[model samples]
Target: METVEDVTRMRLVGGNLALDFINTRTGPAAGPPDDDLLTGYPALIAWGVHAGALTRAEAARLRRLSRDDPGRADTTFARALSTRDDLDEVFRSLAAGGSPTAPALARLRDHEADALAHARLQPGNPFAWTWREDHTLARPLRPVVHAAVQLLTTAALDRIKGCEGCSFIFNDESKNRSRRWCSMDDCGTTEKIRRYVAARRTRARQ
Candidate 1:
């Protein structure tokens, strides 16, 4: 099946799948109006595929499901995005050495239960996991919960970082853990050029 839509404008700079979902609402794409990357249900499906949350066939199936009951699909899509923002806040708080609010943790627990409802052990490894269906609307968000759980329980929390250029969150996987800016070639370079131009202008004014 053909793609539901083009998601080439969506940036996949986040080091993790959950981070990719959070980064969606942060960066504006190039072009007129420069809208949010996940603008609607179709856009969300495309993002899921681009971000490795879903395969092309899975995305196509989700596209059909969403179109079948557009209202519920829209509501679910909105809820997923809202959860993404909440996750962003929760992660930011945790990364800053503050505890997540009860409600935040509660919400994550809810997502965790829902995610597990459709999960199954993979064939070869009892430890390996897999989702039951790709067409489910919220299936794309299951990884977000899993990723969040991993960071909350492991050393990765220490690597959580905010991009100085645009405030997008990413995991710092560099050897020195010095990664910043969701994408060095994009936001990083853009900000560097802006600062350079401003400094040159200031020097000329002196």
Candidate 2:
């Protein structure tokens, strides 16, 4: 009964991990966009692959498990979408030049704790933190939860930004820190065309 899109449309323009996770929805956060790329368990897993939270093999395995275990898979998908929305709230406050309140911060911490409760210290590069879960369909999202916690606790929030063209969040990591737009090829181009058209229209009217 569930409709699914195998290809992931989630954008990865956000320069930071958490911001990239939130960019999955392509339009206004509240309004229904053309489509939510994260439509089902497969979509969530696909996003996981795109976000580097899971390898191709891992994502493919999770997708297969979703079909076999629809009941728990559905619940996992729901929780992933819910966390995505809650992250929107947490980052929205930061993007608006305000710190997340105590309640908001608590919610983030709760999610972080819940995520790690399912993870363990994964060994790899000494500088990296990793975990491997054999059966948690929702395991991929734990990295995102941790990424959110990292951004909130560090000075990374200071570089956070929203695209004026489409409200897609990103980090301005330019040398001068003046970068904007989710991407120079997409939203940036659109805004340029918009401004050019506006200037031409004004000249014609005058």
Candidate 3:
């Protein structure tokens, strides 16, 4: 049985997925950071959290994988981040959802198979295997994460926001919904302080 801790960890990791999707940088330099783009499993799980599917503990565990076993980090990251055609087909099938043809379902199944195989190779606790564990419990977790993504993407795909300073995604659920950055502590504070100093200089010029 999975514990509360497991779920929480996964949530953190899943949240990153949403963040990676936005990639909100500006100018010629506008691109995902190497770390955010390269870290795969954690980001995928983090996407789940941002979608409100996985608990925090579950997300955290996914995060821990990169730290605990750096060896598999690049490989797992690549696998997780790859935007394969099959995934698109899966999404199409999911959207349609009326006993999708075997070929379409097979595409999704193959994608999951590859993902599960990669996940199993990475080192972690037994629950980590739940992602690839081929068990009753594992089966449900997969769709829960997927459904969370689908729900968020469908409802707020246009409004979904990402941080310019870092790759983090969050729903613009604020009453104002004008959120452009991820957190006040990170980029927000830095940008505000810089602007304050710049404004002070302009006032002195006057």
Candidate 4:
């Protein structure tokens, strides 16, 4: 059960924006998610803001635009969900030492193309790509796709991993690539307590 506070204070365990977006749905390892943070288009915008993909002012404007055109908002929200699934498929396959499906790769390529089309190169000591201030319902997706492109093309692509305890995906930036859980405070602690209890129960029975 996701609430406003949940979205606002959601954990940013995934080191990359695209990976973090994939981590939106939280559940046990084998079944349905207990909480999906992006309940609607507004929730999507809130997440984008929380993830630093969109500025607060930009999120506010996008929310107002979504209210004005609910049909488009719904369509955009549906697209976002689809993208999230496709991304998960791609990353999950890679993490499991496999290739992404052709259709998923094609869909991601299309989104990256669209994102790049709307972005402009900002002049700086190190030039960077930035999204245009477009008043579109799909504005929040720009940075997400950008991050996806970055991860897909970089050495860090090999570091993509799924949590041992749950469905969450994250970049394993540990020096030895030995990090297992999404966070030590969440899944790690839970698994530790579960193992300890099970061992104690076994000893008592014996």
Candidate 5:
């Protein structure tokens, strides 16, 4: 059974993945003094799922793979995740500052292709519409979903950054550079409290 911390960490990873693919730095802040977005492939996938860019079945398959065989998930995510190193090389090779073709890009392209293929395979499948008004709506909204994923991925890759403490990706535009954790209200506060308590303990001992 995965703990809450594990799930949170995975969520951060997934977000970072989207950030890397889009080459954007417009996600949640990382910590104080450096407001960087977390990056990871799983986080990207999660974003897609939440944004209605990916089918529930596809998301379920990924989650299952992640839980049952973490190695498989890691391999898939590693291939799917993009990085600054990739963009730097890609942009340098492009005529109009476009992205270049590399192993990582190839992997992302492959995943996109695979997703499209899967979407096509279930053109009329009822399971595709998990949140639809009508469960039987076989609308074949794959094109729209793909477009959303593409746009989001592009945005994330362009605006996302990695967190120093955790390998997450988020947008970093805080004035004080004190935006640590995926959510300041969640991990950030908890960490602050822990640190404060530790400091108090140290003072009492002294």
Candidate 6:
């Protein structure tokens, strides 16, 4: 079972809420992810807090509510996992220079509708969508859905890319759009070492 420690240690290299959510599972290429951090409802809450999707206070309240209702929490956790998979499929397709399947898009549209239905418009210089303050078990999902909707319907769509070293999808915000790895500390460093070792082996053989 995943713990708060695991959630805290997760690297948020996606640079977007939806992408971060998708990255809960890591180390995938042609097969299933090797690590899935969201083990249960509590882990979900921890991730929400870690990912800045929920405030500590909000996470506390949700934790209390989940403790009082385990069945509902289980359901919410399952739904969240399913939504994450759908998002992975959709965005991975986009990053591969293809359109998302209709079914996946429809599932995402449903999640977006749910998020919007619970949101209110905030009046400002530029009016923005804000989530309603509720103690609902699914509240953590609201921000993630909103981010996904924005990415899908806006210019950010073109900025999404799959990391060359991992299965994580990130919003490439570089000026030259040359980002290839998820992070320099992890995949990038590993790839560099791998290349250096290969070069040394070739030099020795020659």
lDDT of 1 by residue, 10-127 (tens): 6777677777777765543322222356667888877877887778888788888888989988998888888886787787776566778999888888887888787786777447
Residue clash pairs of candidate 4: none
Among the numbered candidates, top lDDT falls to: 6
Clashes (candidate 2): 0
For each candidate, what TM-score against the reference?
0.83, 0.86, 0.45, 0.92, 0.37, 0.95
| Alpha-carbon lDDT, every model | 0.74, 0.77, 0.45, 0.87, 0.43, 0.88
Q: What is the Å distance of residue 159 in model 5 from its true position?
A: 5.3
**What is residue 180's positional error in candidate 5, in angstroms?**
2.3
> Which structure among the candidates has the greatest TM-score?
6
Q: For candidate 2, write residues 1-206 as lDDT tens digits.
A: 22344335456778667788787766753344444567778777877877788888887788888889999999998988888878887887788788777876788888898887777776676555565664578887888988888776775666787777775888788888787788888888988999999999999999
lDDT of 4 by residue, 1-206 (tens): 57755777878998899989988887876567687888889889989989999898998898889989999999999999998988888888887778899999999999989888888899998998887566678889888987987898884666888888998888999999988899999999999999999999999999
Q: What's the true lDDT of residue 96 in model 6? A: 89
Give the alpha carbon lDDT tens digit for every residue of 142-183 in model 6.
Answer: 899889888888756678999888888999999988888899
Q: Candidate 6, clashing residue pairs?
A: none
Model 4 TM: 0.92
Model 1 TM-score on a 0 to 1 scale: 0.83
* Descending-TM-score candidate ranking: 6, 4, 2, 1, 3, 5
Query: What lDDT does candidate 1 reach at residue 110?
Result: 88
Error of 6 at 138 (Å): 0.4
Regions more than 4 Å wrong, model 5: 2-49, 54-101, 113-159, 163-167, 173-178
Error of 3 at 7 (Å): 15
lDDT of 5 at 196: 100
- Please say which candidate is ahead in lDDT: 4 or 6: 6
Show model 6 residue runs off by greater than 4 Å: none
TM-score of 5: 0.37
